[model samples]
Target: MARVETLKRQFFKCLGLLAGCTSFALWASQPQVVEKADKTELEWGNVLFEYYQKDYFEALIEYEYAKTINNDTAKSDYGQMLQGGMLLSYGQAKQSQEIFDRVLARSADPLVRNRAWYYLANLYYHKSEPEKAHQSLAKISGPVPSDLFPEFYHLTSLINSDVENLAQAENILSQVPEDSKHYPYVLFNVAIGQLRSNELKKSLINLTKVNQYAARSEEHASLSDRATHGLAQLALKSGNLPTAWANLQKIRTNGLYSNRGLLTYAWTAIKIKQFNEAIPALEILQSRDIAIPEVQEAKVLLAHLYEQQGAPRKALKSNLISIDEFAKGINRVAEARDIIAKQNVPEEFVRNLDVIIDDSDWFGAQPSIDYQKLTPFLIDLMSSRILNETLKELSDLYAIKKNLENWEFQSNEHLLIMNNADKKSISKEERKAIQRSKAIQQQLSDKKQELKLLMLSLKPEEQKRFQSTIDSIDKEIAILQSRTDGMSRLSQPYKQPASVKKEMKDKHNQVKQKLKQTSRLIAKLEPVVRSLVNEELDKHEERMRYYWAQSRLAKARLYDTTLMELDNVTSNKESGEGVK
Candidate 1:
């Protein structure tokens, strides 16, 4: 009981550390807003308010609007940095990189520069470019803002991890105050770093301490099961069967690790000739609620055990049952895969798919597609890590794509309103505003090229790292070129005031540009999502085919055994010594 208590605490501590790394990554630490006021000041306040409320989309909109109207160029650099981070969170990594570069190139503020450098380093870290990311981090002038410290340290640790600098990673992790909520997790991280470095003895010692220092719950018990399971496997490898058995017993019976545990437990029992325990365990596992490869393998082993115990008939019956089950499973999976291949994954399904992040199985549940169509097929794939991850990525991409579409729709509506506005009473100020819109449109064209050139110049490593960004920009540019080549009105009848007509033209151009950008973004992400879905389906089909082959082989072996048994029975009768 005490051991279980300790296990839960240690595991939960590690889990919380992971949650911190994710949920506290970038904008989660932004300072909350206390007041809202009106133009730049007002928009900025709303940005902060929306951010604090976790309404990141609204916050980004307010920030972009604030940028358009704000007069303070110095402060704009800082605000753009924040906007860049929000874009990164929205999976707009390439756009975020552009913002970071612009801030670094134009801003002289140390604090702003530091924040910008930090984000740039973070972007590099995500790209798996350690040296480049490290170079970016080195450009920071002083301590990062206090609000950014946690995420900053996390990124540093990631860099250190990539470089195999375990000493620095451990040292940084060790700085967590003992009283802080992150303290246990920091200790957990140090142990993990040691484990990753293959300092197994040290890691086990630290893990032991972690378990001793904290209390626990069943909620995060799977992590404990995983650690214990590893220890069992290590013991078995070293010929310490007793130690392996004991360690395997510690795993929870209904946790994420339970399926593999039962399979391991039964195998270990069979190896030790503990038939009483092994048989019942395998029997219990033969139930169809779980269909992991481990469970299927255990069933095969169970039949072999029966054969070894002289129950040839029982073994044959068991193998036949499994062969039948596998046959149905293969056919059902094929039909399901065919159905999936015939239709695109529904956008709404991908958009609504819940993200599951279990360390044991990742997306560990059936996808959000119509289960009725693929019921039994999907059942066998519940614990697929690849499917989980692919589906989750698709969900996020679809969601971002939908957001871009909404923006595109809004721009179209805004353009229509501007195109049809009453022009009889236009003021001089409004005309200047129209001129400013035209100038900004020209600037947008210039900046689009600038952002692309920057994308092309990113650290060259198979071009895979920044390829998505470059492709997106190329697609957007191509879209613009196509539109430019297709149609234009060289002249227009001026029904409204001359200024009003000019304003209308400028507004029309701006709206068209915004619409193009949004449409291009949606276009860029949709194909990536569909390709991932297709890849996931292909991998699943491969697994099903492999399962079918294994079952066929097992069945063939069972048939051979039956023939041998019949020959033995005939030989015994001829000898007149076998009459049981």
Candidate 2:
């Protein structure tokens, strides 16, 4: 019995040893688990995610923590943040380039390298180096980040086009999916290329697609009009005048292509001998403040039509009216110049001339006069010592009023938010909730870390058991984060002080006094400008009358010559009768 018992114990020991060895072998065969990202790396990723979502304020906060980490991922994301101007000014783009270059050269991760290359390409594009941008883009061989794919394809197409590789550009554009936000732009460019290549049918097809897509989006209304204009041009080229006219009529009157379409419509009407139909379109074009290049042609056409209708005097009068209108504009420019020459403007006003011009509502109201045509006048005014000074004072006064209004608006908004928070007693409850949520979040994060560590020691089967628990914890953490997010934002420190309101009030009063003084000075100067303008207008009127009188004199001479010829013909016929 004792020998049997000994055999049983030995058998059990052998079985235990065999099981232990099996376990060791299985562990040895398993691949070594790579360590998951630590807290700082995770935070860096979160910052990048927020930035991707365009939540700039929240991203900025996370960036502050991530920027201190020594990891390559953190550095790469920080560089992107800088490039995006989340925490840095746009002036720091050069610095951002340097950081991206460092990451591209040093990072081991393929995704990081590709991302850095993409950013470098963008910077190069902005710097107007399309060749370098193209080269950087070509370095991206692997799968691109999903969010950047559309921009990637769009930019590649653009660079190809810039390099005059139209075929390549078209090929790249073709790869853009139909559902992509860039699809309309891509299709439009492709259509233009096709049109240039004389592939009219294909171009028309692409243009129709663009029109259909644009019609669904309010933001693309101008694009829709342009596509319609393209269709009109194509129809006209194909000698389908009625089809062309129908397409032209579809363009909205307020659209960007309206002027071109209207001009074409008038020209088409004339081609079809619909004189009356052409007249209204020409009149509208002529009356527009910004002189379209086609206006002169339209005026000549109108004059010819008027003569064809046996209204020579009306044609002459129309020509005179057009000339007078042009002369009046020139006179206004001259008046502005004279005002600058005579005024003794103060330095304060001179310094703020640009701001004054930018903020002035007067220019916006004068839509009849093309602002470009007034460039010389504005330049002279700004360069003039006295006029610039006066203009600057007006600008400063406008700016002061705007600033006061903005301050009051911001103060009211802040007060409303504060009052609501206080009334709801949300401040304290929010603090407590945030603290509790954060505490819970930390506990869950620690558990995740613990699980990750345990997984390294566990067999494959053992590791699977903890995954469900980790996933549950992750969901809980996500919920807690969502609930506390508002509180977290609310707890952020307010940078503006209550005392700013008082300061704004004081500034407002000071600006009011200055505005009154400036207005009075401007009043004193305006009459001088008005007198010069009247003098110039009188000169223009006299010149116009002289031209009109000359035209009438020439007409009278021609008419007298025709009467004399008729009398001579009658005398010839009487002499022939007498000879017979």
Candidate 3:
């Protein structure tokens, strides 16, 4: 009986040992989460992660928070954000330059210094100071971040191009790897350089490569359209009408190349005696925005096509329309020039008027009587009154503009989603989902602030209960964030409704009609406004002249009285001498 009990105990101990080893193996196989050593470092990492994701607003918020902590990395990142125009307008380039200069001058970290130099170079480039840009680029000696390498090379090539150093630009462009996102841009610019140099064969080869890559990737549509347009131009120059037509056909309508492409297409069709094709292309070009420079050319082409089709009256009408458009354009220019000449107000005042006119809500509930003493305030009041009355008279038009803006925003959002879907990347979709979640999280954070305000009104017992609820919300948020961190980058594609698109288009047309009507009203009213402003200024000038004349007369009277006093003194002296 003792031997049987001992055997059972030994077998149980072996089974327990085997179970422990299996648990240890499972633990070893699982992925590990490494915690950052410092709290500030973790926060700084979060800022960098947000920046990498192109969540500039979130990055800026995190950076602002991180700045209170004594961390050099956080300071460097904040400076980088300022220099990159992520947290400010590009108009603040001078301020950005100053921040970069401080980092470059004082940063002990080589990496920080290099980034500062890179951003400084970009600023100089934008400012059109290429020599200074080159100097800034020279300051970057050490290794740069991988993501910035392509930008560095591209900027270098651009600077070379700006200086007309085609050889150097070509050499620099050659260093850009095929897989770089900037590769297509570099290739296009290089082809342009070759074309300018009259290296037709080389240019064609490079352009063809860009076209093929853009088509296969289904990206950079603008670049692809440009490449096709370039090919068309080349074919036309080489007298290859068919090739030119084919190249022009590849270019999508309503693109950067559209007007020129359509015009070229029509001309090429005319060359091939395809009147039917030529007429449609010309008509399409004419139907485009009147603001387009090609509209007049398209009219002439249409007139020619009409004449060829033996429709003399139609051709005459086309010519008449072209002349009418030109006359209207000249009248507009003359009126603008006249206003500028007569209205001698400062440019700043005019710009202020522009702002107030464009945004009715700019003043926010109108200014008080005290504030009306300010020139800007007065101008805003006048402009707001004018715009409000105009809008009231054209209430239907105003409603259309409002609806148009709202529908346009929604349409654009849907279009953006569809465009993102075209990329077909799980990682990208995940990032977008994360961004949406973060936006909601931001709203929740704002709610917490509001809740804190509400706490002031609560009794002690109620406060405690409210605080508990807040704490629970905080915990849920933390859990959501944790889950977000582990989520895979996958999302379903978004498709916008056809009805939404149609509504957007309809609203756009209504807004456009309203704009034209408003423009005509302004055309009549602008002259009156200009005359009033000019009259006011003339009155001011007249008042100044009258004051000057009055001062001159007083001076003359003073001079006459001084002379008389001197003469009287002389006569008195003579009479005293005779009495003696």
Q: For each candidate, how many residue pairs have backbone atoms clashing (under 3 Å)?
A: 2, 7, 1
TM-score between model 2 and native: 0.49
lDDT of 2 by residue, 1-580 (tens): 4644543454345344433433433312324444556655666677778878876556656776666765455566535534445422222356667777766666777776777787778767655688998888778877777767888887776666556566877777777888887888777877787777788888888888887776557647778788888898888878898988888778776565677777888888877788788888878777764233445356555665665666766666665565555555446545544444444422222333354445455443334333343333332233344443334334444444454455555655756665554445445755775686567556556655655665666667766755675575566556555655645776454444657656656665665666566567556655544444344445444544444354445445445655887899999999999999
- By how many angstroms RMSD does model 2 differ from the true structure? 17.9
Q: Estimate each model's TM-score.
A: 0.65, 0.49, 0.47
lDDT, candidate 3, 196-257, per-residue tens: 88889988998888876665444567788889999998999899989898889998877656
Off by over 4 Å in 1: 1-42, 71-78, 102-114, 134-144, 178-192, 209-219, 279-285, 288-291, 339-346, 355-400, 407-420, 423-580
Q: Distance from true position, residue 141, model 3, in Å?
A: 4.7
Q: Rank the candidates by lDDT, best first.
A: 1, 3, 2
Encode model 1's per-residue lDDT on 1-580: one tens digit a residue. Answer: 4644443454345334433432422322334554433344655777889878867788887776766675352157767787888887666778999989988888888888999999888877766588888788768776678778777766766677667677877777766555544444455566677878889887777655554333454533555676667677767887888888987787776777777788888889877888767887688678844235565676677787887887877877887777776666556555555555444444544443433222233234555454344433343344454455445445546665566556556766755665675433445654454454344334445655554454454446633654574465445444433433332221232355657657756766665676566556545555554454445445555664665566567668878877897999999888886454
Candidate 1 residue pairs that clash: 8-216, 9-216
Query: Clashes in model 2: which pairs?
Result: 289-368, 345-386, 349-389, 349-392, 349-393, 350-388, 350-389
Question: Higher-lDDT candidate among 1 and 2?
Answer: 1
Among all windows of 10 consecutive residues in model 1, the one with the lowest summed lDDT is 484-493
Best by TM-score: 1
Q: Model 2, 289: alpha-carbon shift in Å?
A: 1.8
Better of 2 and 3 by lDDT: 3
Highest-scoring model, lDDT: 1
